[model samples]
Target: MKKILLLSACLSIIPGTTLAQNTTAGTIELDMPGHFQRQSVSFDYVRRDVMIPMRDGVKLHTVILVPKDARNAPILMTRTPYNADHMTSFASSGDMSSVLEGYDNMTDVIADGGYIRVVQDVRGKYRSEGRYVMNRPFRGPLNGTQVDHATDTWDTIEWLVHNTPESNGKVGIIGISYDGFTALTALFHPHPALKVSVPMNPMVDGWIGDDWFHNGAFREENLPYIYDQDATPKNDEKWWSNHYDAYDLYLNAVSAGALGKSRGMEQIGFFRQITAHLAYDSWWQNQAMDKLLVKEGLTVPTLLVHSLWDQEDSYGAVATWYALENVPTSARNLSIVIGPWNHGGERVEASKLGDIKFRADTGYYFRKKILEPFLAHYLKDSTISLPARVSEFRTGENIWETASKLPAPDCASECKALHLEPGHGLGFTIPGVDAGAAQYTSDPDHPVPYVPRPVLTKGVTGSPWKYWLVTDQRDVASRPDVLTFTSEILTKPLTIEGEPLVHLTASTTGTDGDFVVKLIDVFPDQVSAQPEMGGYQLMVSADILRGRYRKSFEHPEAIPANTPQLYKIALPFTNHTFLPGHKIMVQIQSSWFPLYDRNPQSYVDNIFFAPKAAYKPATISVDIRNSWIDLHTK
Candidate 1:
């Protein structure tokens, strides 16, 4: 009792504290109030937390930050499944830079330009009240409800323009990854106030080439993402790993479906959906954002940002640009900026990714020179004009190039074919002799590791998944199962500005398989500038295709055993130049394991549920005479 009284007296004497006392049966309880307010320092911005009501009566949690001197300021909003509160409170300090540190906030423009900054939790995320659906489909066949991201965005924009008196009634939407998908949705039925949209590294088509799957081969690394994202409403469920090495964990599990069951991921709705639809079906085709955008057309001024080394969603931005470019409206309203960065790397200092260096802070340059100016022109009516339709940061050359057009018509018309010759050589001319085959046995038990092993699970701290795209390919080149073909040292620079097509005529001993193709840039044997990068084999573009989907993505069929079949794969866009003293290389292999799920040599109804018996060794033979890579050159 005396100790409590003494503590209360001490707290009461403190200049900035107060004490309250309550007595029960001669025992006194004292409560000392701690200062909850900042002292001496004043925040330059004001933050308001509100529940913005959607069209369907669901209120989304939103955080709005307005500059103190703001008047008739434009609004910038990002709709995200990621928690709004956590993203808004980036730092303990009141400084705007300290608060909006990452993602698509554009800290410099928001803090200095005096624009109203807003971030909101999508339906059923964080404090938002509603049931969550992974990548909620538009309000039609997929979704029976009237509300979707498009409608929700419409409602939010309508409320923001009308309710927030500090704004000039102009709005822009920007986000990366999944949030980027929401930004794209805003273009469907944009509010009167919504003017511009910037979707960086958006998830355009999960089935064809993004996040969940690349072509028909499932990206096994994303299984944990589904577990974490869809297992609970708050995304509080963490993906737990029982093994130190992901290689053994995935291999030992036998199949992705079995792995999910072992990890208790069956409850996750997305996992269930993924397992159910092993082949590209109406469900996935209908949800493809790029195709949807094509139907909707470009309704607003949109800027698509792509990263050359983006480990995730590398196909989305470029694919979306390709889909909408031919549309008359899009030609005027759509522009794209490609950079040498990783997924969502534009938000951070991006001078380098893994062993590759761009010779400049590419992220900063994109934000300030291209992104900021574009946003300013639309939102703030700034006098600065927008850049060309396409702004690309060319690697190897280490310079930014602008063009009024892309998928350069001349580049495609003058495309060059690099042929795979006998004795593992790469050249532009067709081989004189027909090499029988480059044969290798692909064993599921010893599937080639995507990266050097001690392969840690993705999403863990220090995991190399983020920059794996830029990691050296030399590690896998030595594997016997992987066929390596290299060209002589280049005396002149070779620039490829568009998608490189892989034409393969290969045969598998078994009924099913996967082909992994890589276009690599082999550095000089001795790099004078960076010793660590000497002889480094950097993958310029790569993708995998399941043999079953070679004929059609929607249909699956067994490969005729030991029969050569033509497989054409379109590698992702590469605006890279192979400089003098460097060599061009091509690597072909089966099973980039743990990154992509192991393809059971024997065909099954569903690969996800393939049993242990399905795993087998299969001999793969590539016909060097027929195999060639068509490059879209500048």
Candidate 2:
């Protein structure tokens, strides 16, 4: 009875969200009922695990879902190392079964609207046969640097189309995060059966710069947490033990002062071992998929989805979009959707925000309108058409806006440069209007707490901006090492589209330093905040650039104390229309504690090996003459 009420409530709620565009050329709207009851829809499915043969003779574990009534249905395939069994559990839940039971493991809201779903474990994880290698090659011996997971994906698609009954020889792939990477790899081969794909937050590049690593700086906090949760262990005992280890590590790491000292020392030890290889050496470069995708080319239509606030794999989505856009294939299609939500927050936030109510129907519109038409047209050859572009949901406005392309930079006037004068706070000098220089001390022993706690290590976690929305940095602004800069509130709405580059001319007293730059939208009012609802400010976008590998990711050089250097760091690109009332704020600080590992002031061979005594405060200077962030304005 409770399940029935839940279904009824889901249907009764009207989606107030707006669409990106009002008119899509050939779009066909299906008469979807207001609410779908789980009991009303029924389908027979069989879950059988089979070994999918790869080129290297190692078979990957795969699970297939077939509708009992269908004799011939096109296959919807997904390759994921995050366990197909988890997907099965997700499907077994109430409304999800309506979509999951009929299709392959891929989640299609149109299940009542037909398709076979196929899900396979990647080469090394889960029930897959091969020994799991973390983002390693899918074929050849473990030693080869040239192999990739794409080949393994290509092989799986070929086998599924041939082996699965009622498969119309047409296949579409979809998945989020790493699973998205697998879907994208399958497209590199462009098998005849591969017709469509949706790679959401796919890992297009492997070097720490893209997803796992950021600017060669180990996202130490997120790394251990994700590794502890997602990476498959050598066996069941190991997996279960590691799960407990993760909890122990989390408790120790977050216990105020016991950060570097804890029970899960082995987990932190493992983190140090992996992060020590920071260069874009063989280990990191081999996993990047963009270059390989371009070289092989994609033969299928694709849709790319990412969250503007995506904490885990932000770089992959935008990078892959640009990479695939240049491929010389007519059938190649690229569409992107980004929203102001965390990695997994989009699906769950439908109704209330804390006690405040901003009614939202999370996935219903996407499932019924966008996803349904896309799959129907590609897999079933349905007459449903689609818009050229679609972006739905914005937080403040609580509505959707449609645009042909993402907002463009507001670069109408000459590019202006603001200097970070040693003692002057961040702002354009009004002749003699010297706002006393901003300062804050970044102590490795006592660093600024990164909001929304990073995954596990001591580094910036997923979206610290969310937490910064409420916490005023004004207190930190008075410190000796933190730098705060702000641009005068725009007289007009400033629309910035594309990437922003930060050019800095500075010198550090230490051998290594981290420059964390955040682009924020300062709200009009301040409010008391909570863990979930950090008040007032809305973080549009933020990014961190490691100083050591500024010139080249593969090598690092010590900064001679007091010697000036030129460093140009690429801050994360953002698509936002900064309203006239909002102020643009950029915060530069050397240490974002526990969110990022502390950099010892001394020039050390490896951070992991640096002795605890080496950690100390270092004085740094920023010359604003050559330091400024170039914002692309429309």
Candidate 3:
């Protein structure tokens, strides 16, 4: 259950409350004890709760807020699995004039743009009636009997236009994260009233990237993540772990299945369903939002907002953007904005990431300048124009740029290989061919921590994992298990403005392992005085490739022990300029604990089922002469 807080003096309960947005950047705060000590935002609106029946006859609990002095207004709707209560600011009382607070607290936006806002709980979640299936696949060519998110949204909008008082025929949908994914599904079969959708930071895929798994490796955070999402049905609390050091808990448990079993995941259907399909089988692929849109194509305009350092859903943002390329320009109207943010951090205070300052309030610019204009132009017929097709904030330079498309086609030709030189160096110019390789012994018993801290802070509302993307790396740079390759200070700035990749020519003594390749920016030594800025090693782009899935995500194959093999790990998309004095660095390691489950190193068809006894120390080697990182530098 969401920890509820009533407006009062001398008490605040915003610490552990997670919002429907689910942004890793920061938690939303409901200011208690205002000067007036009012319960909710002050807006003269009529509020009512209605049960809208879906095509399948499942009644979806919804909240409708209409302005009392309202004329014709566009209907802005959002369907969320996080429940609709958060959207409501307050509940109706004996005094009808009393205002309520809600998750869709866009009362200001509604008042300015003249919108009839509707927030709904999706089927099988919270107040909604029907079986809940997470990331439900799109059931296209719907015969009246078949149902999915697309049908549910379509049916809800159909009922809203005719039933809701003061609602103009025009409708627009918007949401972030899981709610954002639902909004993406609605575009497939948009009702006539639906005109625009802004699915910001959508969790498009669970198997490849975003939320559940990343590159075939089961996310270690999944255990606690599910606990916070639906822990109430089983009479459990948000946190499943009683231990302070969460990393040690999962590390001691060994395999993913063991962790799940220890937590009584047998009682959770989603956990069993996820563990059953370790591979990216038809079950996960069919649920991909991009694949869903391919069939029904976007018939309405979409504005995508993403964070360059989005801890959770960056992969979904980039993948979904490209997927729309298959559709015609006219039908698939899409525009995107990538800022220096973490998860939904784009909407929060985004001036700095970690200690590095971007020098401007990017989150403020996105919301006030970008999102506000998009809604106005599309829904309210405002004269304000939409932003360029792609608007990305360049990090090192601290500036924004616009292009016809992301990565700007010209970047493909500018791709250059920065070879890993001898003596822990990075350079574009190759030195004399070297034969020796860097060796590291990776022990599952003493796995490398993703952050410098020993304890893993676990909570959906306030987690240390949320800011791990921007955490400093100096602590791990000296470790024997981590390989650090740095480049000489640049005479001129090298701007990396697109996708980066790690091509490791290596092998492990064990049959199975994971390769975590990270691209970091090492600050100049003179910057070592201030603690936060002191010789900071900031990780820009990084990713992992489970060796077993190198051959195929669908077909698992073990690595041939003591043999050189090429593994291409695609890091996330970034736009950072390596400053003149800074050095480009790459760190390679076998394990990133707590962030991802530790690989057993022993060959198994499914690592989830692998036992703790199977885990052993593996000597991994990376050939300096053969290995290189492909940085898309301009």
| Predicted candidate 2 versus true structure: per-residue lDDT over 5-82, tens digit per residue | 997777666575433235575676556888975452454655556888888788888877676666768887778766
- Return the TM-score for candidate 3, rounded to 2 decimals: 0.88
| Sort by lDDT, top down from the best | 1, 3, 2
- Give the worst 10-residue stretch by lDDT in candidate 3: 94-103
Off by over 4 Å in 3: 1-43, 90-112, 140-145, 231-237, 330-332, 408-411, 460-462, 528-531
Cα lDDT, all candidates:
0.89, 0.60, 0.78
lDDT of 1: 0.89
Model 2 TM-score on a 0 to 1 scale: 0.77
Query: TM-score of predicted model 1?
Result: 0.95
Q: State the weakest 10-residue window (summed lDDT) of model 1.
A: 16-25
Give stretches of model 1 more than 4 Å off.
1-41, 408-411
lDDT of 2 at 400: 54
True-structure Cα RMSD, model 3: 10.6
Error of 1 at 552 (Å): 0.3
RMSD in Å for all candidates: 3.2, 14.0, 10.6
